[model samples]
Target: MGKAAIRIGTAMAALALAATGAPAVAGPQDAGGRAAPKTVAPLMGPRGVDALGHGRTLVTETGGTFSLVVERKHKPARVVPLGNLPTDFPPAISKGPHGTIYLLTGASGPPPEQRPSVLRGAAAPAPATTLFKWKRGWPAPKVVADISAYQKTDPDPWDQEGFPADSNPFGVLALDDGTVLVSDAAGNDLLRVWPKKGRIRTVARLMPRTVPVPAGLPDVPPPMGPLPPAGTPIVSEAVATSVTVGADGYWYVGELRGFPATPGTSQVWRIRPGSTNATCDPAHPRKGACKRYADGFTSITDLAAGPKGIYVLELSKKSWFAFEMGLPGAEEGGLFLVRDRGAMPRVRELAAGRLKNPGGVDVSDHVYVAGPLFGPGALLRLR
Candidate 1:
């Protein structure tokens, strides 16, 4: 599982702590004292957002409904429902050629036993990780790709749990050629899909990184029991969560490093155009088809690339675990911009200490962020 694991696990953790009457855990706190950015539209748990041009934007709620927000100069923005998606959690949306809309939903985590067993004449269910295509005047979107089906057949080579492949299709990028790129957070890979052919091919695989555990964690019971000693280095999944096309015509991906969720362990990777089966391992970073473009990010949930640079949105300013586990001050998230500058790249935080559990971001004429993620959220515009 990718984002779902975090969301669901957080809920369960909160419930357990409440039952046990435990005190709030201490964790990372927001550092910025600057004023928060202005809100563009009030939304309910908005998780995915994309700019639709002409002062319009598309946003998706955690409950599956889509919204279209229209902004006018010196006027309050208007919000309209764009209909609900079939999935409970729609993660990403992209505009395809000729007004086509591509949306992604679902993640790996349904128990194996939960798979409906086929009896006498019952048909099997559709794959959960799906890519949907829709256009105006259509009743609903049509399934263009079954991402989980491909994952089942071609499992993750670096799967930590062993057997039973995991596939959380989190990020999507639609190209002018009708081919779509998807980032699978659980599978730790990037896939290229041909909508017309209903075929999928692996573009790159992200290798797990070794992250040092942060200090000040408590030891608990079985299941999630005991924390490893602080500063202990452990291997973590490369939870690749986002994909965006850069101004240079190259593909950019951001990772949400898994378990222990060490802050500043995530990295943004760059993949060459037309690359296939590329490796994004830190061990052989430069030698592979995928190379590190930027590093030292924490729990990046979404990325947006523009002519100037790329916008990176973190789910939590602290590590995701700190936020998920409800550490005292881990409520605040962050937004950052990464820009190329000669031999060095500059990473700057924007509207610091303003965002809380921000999930998705995109740039058209302006930068748009969606957040608060678990509660009543909103779509905010950068100044």
Candidate 2:
């Protein structure tokens, strides 16, 4: 969920969670009395969308514009100019104070354009990792946080993916408590920017799972066909990606468990009051404090707290990688709900096979979701 944000009914929750592999949820007609339409008209490269303060929808796109799109058809869009700002496309959005919009961005660079490493071998040049606060009356949007300045990456790590400055702050939230929550997907941590306190806290740290080389053959064709390489650590990284402060008054962070996607490895964490960076440990996850709230999401893209509870937007393991690499699978995207809190918080699917690589979701009147994101991806109302 660059992302989204609930749950209840224990035995019932468990039963619904068990339906994870079932087809997407279907219901009666939508507003305007339409048959649960498959998808809204497609937009361009989408990074995130959130239900605005006015109950309208705000969508972030890469072509240097942040737009407010009314969910209904024939409504004209209002564009916010991002002049030399947000660096790249804002990867996520959240509601802010007094009609303000918080745009969370990835480390500056063009949103991953999927340039084949075989060609453009150099890692794309990184930019000023930052968060922007946008609203009317300001000469320009304010850079609320210089995200890279706050990141303290692994002093020493085995992965050769370069340095700590590679922080991609994906999801963002501006809480009523005067704190800002940002998820650093590349850095693998949830950060709290306390402006007045003059401190940035690593509230939750997500560890990268080491998927050891199978003692068998490889799944994809090794470029070096004759000499098969040794067990390659599938370390694309499923670090902390999305975050939201739930209606329950606690904060939640979601993961996009790196490559070789472990079925149930991706998770959502609950952060309680008074919990510090060191306390919310996956090593010793404590229930209602820093515990895993939900599991088994394919690739948790964004999180939204809305009418149907907390909805998990899966980027769909297959389709996401299809453009990133060339691996193919069902590649179907979906939306799931966090069934309950406490340990092993269950998640149940609500919509499936309709989304592609959804990056952001805004839960409001119609439960609007955007993307299977790539090339201005489409928006759809969950039926």
Identify the leading candidate in terms of TM-score. Answer: 1
lDDT of 1 by residue, 216-274 (tens): 66665677658788899888888888999999999999998887888988899989988
- Writing each residue's lDDT as its tens digit, candidate 2 over 93-184 gives 77666777676656534334532233111112234566777665554556676677776443213222555445677788878776778888
lDDT of 1 at 6: 38
Best by lDDT: 1
* Sliding window of 10 residues with minimal summed lDDT for model 2: 1-10
Reference-based TM-score of each model: 0.88, 0.74
Q: What stretches of model 2 exceed 4 Å from their correct place?
A: 1-41, 53-55, 71-86, 111-127, 152-162, 195-199, 212-237, 279-283, 319-323, 341-344
Candidate 2, RMSD to the unseen true structure: 9.5
Clash pairs (backbone) in predicted model 1: none
Poorly placed runs, candidate 1 (over 4 Å): 1-35, 108-126
lDDT of each: 0.76, 0.57
